[model samples]
Target: MPTEPEPQRPPVGPAPARHELDAERLRAALVRGADPDAFYRRLDVVTETASTNADLLAAARDPGTDRRVLLAEFQHGGRGRHSRGWAGVPRAQVIVSVLLRMPGIDLADLGWLPLLAGTATVDAIRSVTGVDAELKWPNDVLVGGRKVAGILAEVAGTHPEPVVVVGIGLNVSLTEDELPVPTATSLALAGATDLDRTALAEALLRELARRWQQWYVAGWDVTGPAAAYRERCGTLGRRVRAVLPGDTELHGVAADIDEQGRIVITPDDGGEPIAVSAGDITHLRPVP
Candidate 1:
């Protein structure tokens, strides 16, 4: 009796060459139309780093270190919300962190920093690659419901002027197999035509700067960014499960984002709505 050939695995192909970032080209582009009074005073690109967020957080301890931008071609110790581990393919993602003084922002409103980063990143991805990216509440950026970027905002100083280090890790050229997890996607896998690191970095910084400047000028006003975030937030108007610290959970419909950037979840069982300041959220369904 003839038997079907033992199930064969797909043939493996050689991996593509790792693209190294051109710091000289990036620096030149950033300086050609440089704004003397821009929020970003200095932009530095590094070949590799333990963690750009940690480096910038340490820098923020010195008042003079405000307004500096640090980008790493690779992050060996990158992290996301809840200290989730992260790392990037060499020059395949925009791994950047920005340090800024709080500029008299209220403590309660600090949550918006990471949210703002998500919004900025989504917009940047769209602008640079023509890919439609959306936000997953506070920190994750998504393309077609799969994670594409993660944002982390750490508060450093807390005296005369509090400083924050906002780090963004965006997957630009990661192949499908290189995705951090099965639930994640990258611009490359999402069919983006432009994967140039310099162009993506420029777009990310520009969009981030524009949004940060607006929020800063308003003295940390949540009105504008909040509206913009709600618009881009895919979590809103969906059924979700909010998991707070210690594994506590609340199942409800994502109603609205409050002034302090908390996601308000209204329980479908006629229970009172609750606002979550920090937690993990799983999108369940679109609210009908």
Candidate 2:
């Protein structure tokens, strides 16, 4: 009767926490069901970095590096338009940067790159989270009038071929207390039930690639992309204040975005419409 010996059980600890994006899983998902020669030639997921943009920009200097994507689980020194710093919880956001070497594209059309990125971000967020995300001028992605994502495009190098690095930082599962500012919101906070970073990143990259191809094939034409951006831009037709460089300010109604991607504003003082190439926009509330 000694045949039935008690089986020894190994001790079990607490269950391992789940991550929104397993690096390997994310990499596999990005390449799966995608074209073999897709614009995203390489996908890298890092545990932490000063900035994915910085990493990709450095890689772009090699000349051999092109269409490389770098994603970070957490970014301690991330930045946005105007040198503003951005931070998000580890594994709770999609922080990515892409390197592109556009040799034949006209330099004049380079102005539209940020807007194109903004448009792609809006589309991806809307499709993935069911949130009506909109663009704020050149780079901010807003949902319900709060910033959920931001895009930054920088010219990395231009000696042999023009290399541009575009970075996108999207908040996914931060809680109310984790928000950097009152005007910031995350997808989870915005009521997105599916906070899957892998799916979100894939959707964003696909949209960006599609838009990039369209822009490239059109010889960097702004007509199509401009219209698409205007349709989803919440700044247009709203009263706003433009904090121009050097502390100059202009208060006006955001009339439209010109073909060059500048914000055309009709000054409130009845002055001529001014095209703002760069400025900080503040949406003004209507006076009672």
Candidate 3:
């Protein structure tokens, strides 16, 4: 079988003045009109890194830490689902990783974290940039049928409390020529008039904080989040193909997102609806 080609990296050049995120301004904006003790209570922006998720996961956990959001201007080793590389020009994307600590709960419930991040991103993009964003099942955020962002969740700790790092990479101002692939798009290309990474960051964190607080207080209930996610999801009701683990493939129509956060697909084979624990899903268009 032929291997898939690696995604191209954005050509390395001097970081443009128009793309820099002001660390101070972003922190201030996040704190305004928000509870001081919110889950997304801390913020850090760096110039470069291998991956924000890796750095925060490897760092010594601070006992006083709440949810800390880490952003990097450029990432050389960033990854998405299935370990696919994600890269972009310095300061041209809203690359962030948030460390979330949840109370002890059933392991299956942890799946909601990634979905929460996806829904939050869609709402944030729509709220901040006026772009109509939608969530593809699992981890993708799409605008006008092009992928604009991806979510990756990594487990950090799970003994005393379940801790997960949710990483989100969004193309902010990449030109047409800079997209890693033809299917990818940036806010600029998606008709977002304002490309301020700071504003987008503030909006994203605020949404995450608000929704996360509700989930935490409710003991990780999926009722509200699941319903909201289904509404924002573009995958439901679409004919699709999902590549499950062990390279098995299933053709189906995305039917629903169950309480455990897995996608329930009605198989094309006339079998019963099955909830996939995890998979790489591709939405298939109807035959005209």
Candidate 4:
């Protein structure tokens, strides 16, 4: 018999600074719920993985495995939309990935999954920590205009076999020094003391499961998430600049996100609302 070739793995990025978080205890806490199976099939914990998204995608593709969630105390190679690199202190953040089998959903709709997850995550953080967390369009969550969390959604399995994996990384107790960018912030620094990573993770998972069911069952209605997202979205009604897919720039007032999850903007040059599917947005000034 010929020798089998080894599997190829994604490149490993910089590791998050190590810290202590008891993944076992967190898993136990999660499984105690009456509907544990609804939220997480099996809470697979790892000290470090290249990325939880990558791990969950792998699990979703396993021959005999059902959809599962991956909870990691540390991720050596976490990535965001557009393949942006993000790192954190191990155990100082909440990094989780939920594997979903949504066979009926169109591939185009997958782009909105990140926003759906963002809306749920913001709700959970607000409920548990009593702090104001805001969404910065598409997939970034901010606290007082500083990035506190991010989401990345990936789809695996093709045609007859389709799966969606939504990954989330939150700065639970990350310090000032760990922030890779000047505008990034953390819950602890925002006066969200008494950090409880376990409870927060459970809350996040529960919220995600609830919202995901709502979206999936409701045919991915962006109305619900868009409504909630708008309430906490810092960009809405703000003068902003958007970098479109073609690298062109447009200055406008972010009016709202439509029912289909498009960024609805009214241009400063007086055209009708422009619906954008992809872009990087920056606040220009307060809406006048």
The 10-residue segment of model 1 with minimum total lDDT is 1-10
For each of the candidates, the C-alpha root-mean-square deviation to the true structure, in angstroms, is: 6.1, 12.7, 4.4, 10.3
Candidate that scores best on lDDT: 3
lDDT digits (tens) for residues 1-288 of candidate 2: 011122232233322232856666655655533545556667888889999998987787686888888999899998877798877678878999999888786677777887898999999988988977898887899877788898899998767767899999998877767779878877776777778888898899889989889878887777999999999999999888899999998988899999889999999889999999999998876533
Reference-based TM-score of each model: 0.90, 0.90, 0.90, 0.86
Runs of candidate 1 with Cα error greater than 4 angstroms are 1-18, 29-34, 286-288
1-288: candidate 3 lDDT, tens digit per residue:
222243453444432346678888777667533546545567889889999999878752654554788999899899988898877688789999998878766777888988999989999999889999999998799887789999999988887777888999999888777889888988877767888898898888889888888887887778989999999999999888899999999888899999988899999879999999888888786534
Candidate 2, run of 10 with poorest lDDT: 1-10
Q: Which scores greater on lDDT, model 1 or model 3?
A: 3
Which 10 residues in a row give candidate 4 its minimum summed lDDT?
Answer: 1-10
The predicted structure with the larger lDDT, 1 or 2, is 2
lDDT digits (tens) for residues 141-177 of candidate 1: 9887788888889989778867889998888777767
Give the local distance difference test score of model 2. 0.82
**Model 4 Cα lDDT, one tens digit per residue, 44-114:** 77778889988777776674554577877778888888898876567888899888777677776677678
